[model samples]
Target: MTDAVQQKEANTRVAWIAGVGASAGLGAALARRFARGGLSVAVTGRSRERLDAIVAEIERAGGQALALPGDVTIESELAAIARQLVERGTLEVAIFNAAGATRAPTLDLSAGQFEAAWRVTTLGGFLFARAALPPLLATGRGSLLFTGATASLRGRPPFAAFAAAKAGLRSLAQSLAREFGPRNIHVAHVIVDGGIDGERLRTSAPQRVAERGPDGLLDPDDIADAYWYLHQQGRSAWSHEIDLRPFNESF
Candidate 1:
């Protein structure tokens, strides 16, 4: 290849964020954060419209972004995303933020419901990491970040299914970190310890939002900032797991 082409490739860095939803959600915030930092971002989710809207917003802010819509639970889709990322640019960061779980009584939670939660958060994370690692390894320096919840550490009432799934994901992140850290890959699991102040919570539990008062809920942008910080850390000081919560939130 010509020197000009080589230079172009060297300058191009990409960050892939999965599970993007609302424009005000954490996933969208992550995409915008990485893009603002000069890394071209590729966002994926089941909703093409949502992904496109996020891409547009990023572009409007003078950042490059592409929408690669697909279900995180599908193995085939993740493999295809890997190929697309390779074709697009050097993937310097890959974040698995897909979460699938619903609060229901233990008796009401069917086996299928329990498994579905695992498939989306745990299984999907495995597939995404498997697919993303190749490109990341090619770069020889990449960061894989997983989003976890308070459930990752404890199972509360009505959230048994969600807790189990997040716990599994946490374990997965740990294993990957142990195996990949020696290879120069940074794997981190971020435990979001409080309710997020975003579209989902605001729409679903407006009353809860009010009860939290100012700075009670975790800000999506602040969460995104944490991810960004993790990705930028030096190898010697790398952190494998971190918990984020509001100041007033109990541990």
Candidate 2:
């Protein structure tokens, strides 16, 4: 291919995956994948120091990245980030991966705990979608993908707070998909059924690590590859939801 054509092909691809939580071992892996593909990335989280560190790692590996620190629960922050990205240029894809979970018996869960989970998982996803709509519409084509869990599809004991929040997210994803599909924007959700290898598993509950099999755990790179595939789908054949689990994982 001609140099100009090759450069143009590279320039059109860009992705912004939000939420680099302690459990988001997948986010860093995904960031590396996108960076290797020559896409400029923006990684956001509540911790500025951690975000900066992730940016540094990406850059050191010859990838371009910007660390955007903000809480998804804050509407103003979401708006500002959206505006900043729009000002730079088109945002071809956006992945809402920020999630919060509270494991407790349903009866023991306090009002505050329930609200907090909702704020992070459900409300945060809503706010991000609302803030990003205008710019995504401006591009005339884009993808909005959410990271979900098995709780979204079914409720289980000891996870009332998290289950409710994830269920709400699933509903939101479906509603958005229907509302925006006609506008050429793809809205989808991925239900990750296995544990991710991150700080949480490494430090808090090493025994749980075996649940994801001898492969260690579902790598963020694998999940990121799935996101990339969803983004590339045609309008007619778009998939709205996908459930992924480690090979050794049962149920």
Candidate 3:
């Protein structure tokens, strides 16, 4: 390939991951994965400090990274994220990892809490996809991935709000995949079952570390591997949705 052509190829390799969450678990791992692959990465979240920290880690490892801290719940903020990427280059991969879960009995849950859950998971997923898709479609070929939870399929117990939100997101993914697949834009959703072994989950439920035992909790890095795999799938055999869990996690 000619030098100019090769340089253009490198410039077009960009990935955007949103909803870094408090500890930046899956989002940070994904940023590292793509950055290490030599792609220009832009990460977004409500926490500026956490985003910067992730950006620093990637940069320290000799990878390019940009931190654009913003809330996934806001439409304008998400639009700005998309605008920034379009101004700089193109969106090759857009991953929505922002999620929130609220545990409360239907009778005890406050209206605010229920609304907040839907805002972050369902509405937020819609806004992110709306902003990310145009740019992704501009690339002629790219991936739009959403991180889902087991709640996506089942609504049980104290997770009514979370389950409803996730189910909505899954539905959104399905609709988008069918609409954009023919245009070469691959949209997929991943249902992450079980507890993710990370700073947030480990610290929150220390006692469960032993309760579940070996291979009980899901690995963030391992889940990240699946995200990368989905992004790399060939157009001839694209996967619309995938479920991930630890080996010992029950169905």
Among these predictions, the greatest lDDT belongs to 1
TM-score of each: 0.97, 0.91, 0.94
By lDDT, rank the candidates, best first: 1, 3, 2
Model 2 CA lDDT for position 152: 94
Residue lDDT tens for model 2, 1-251 = 78776566445556777887542577777677777777777777898887788888889989888788889999999899887776445688888888887888889989999999999999999998998888889878989999999899898889888999999999999999999988999999999987876776677778787554586577777888888889889988999999988777778
Model 3 deviation from native, Cα RMSD in Å: 2.9
CA lDDT of each candidate?
Answer: 0.94, 0.83, 0.88
Cα shift from native, residue 158, model 3 (Å): 1.0
Q: Cα RMSD to native, each candidate? A: 1.3, 4.0, 2.9
lDDT of 2 at 200: 64
Residue ranges of candidate 2 with Cα displaced over 4 Å? 1-13, 22-24
How well is each residue in 164-208 modelled by candidate 1, as lDDT tens digits? 999999999999999999999999999999999999999999999
Flag the better candidate by TM-score, 1 or 2: 1
Candidate 3 lDDT, tens digit per residue, 1-251?
78787677547678999977544377888888888766788999887888888888888899988899888899999999899888657689999988778899999999999899999999999999999999888779899999999999999979999999999999999999999999999899999999887777777778987788899988888888898899999998999999999989999
What does candidate 1 score on TM? 0.97
Order of models, best TM-score first? 1, 3, 2
Model 2, 10: alpha-carbon shift in Å?
13
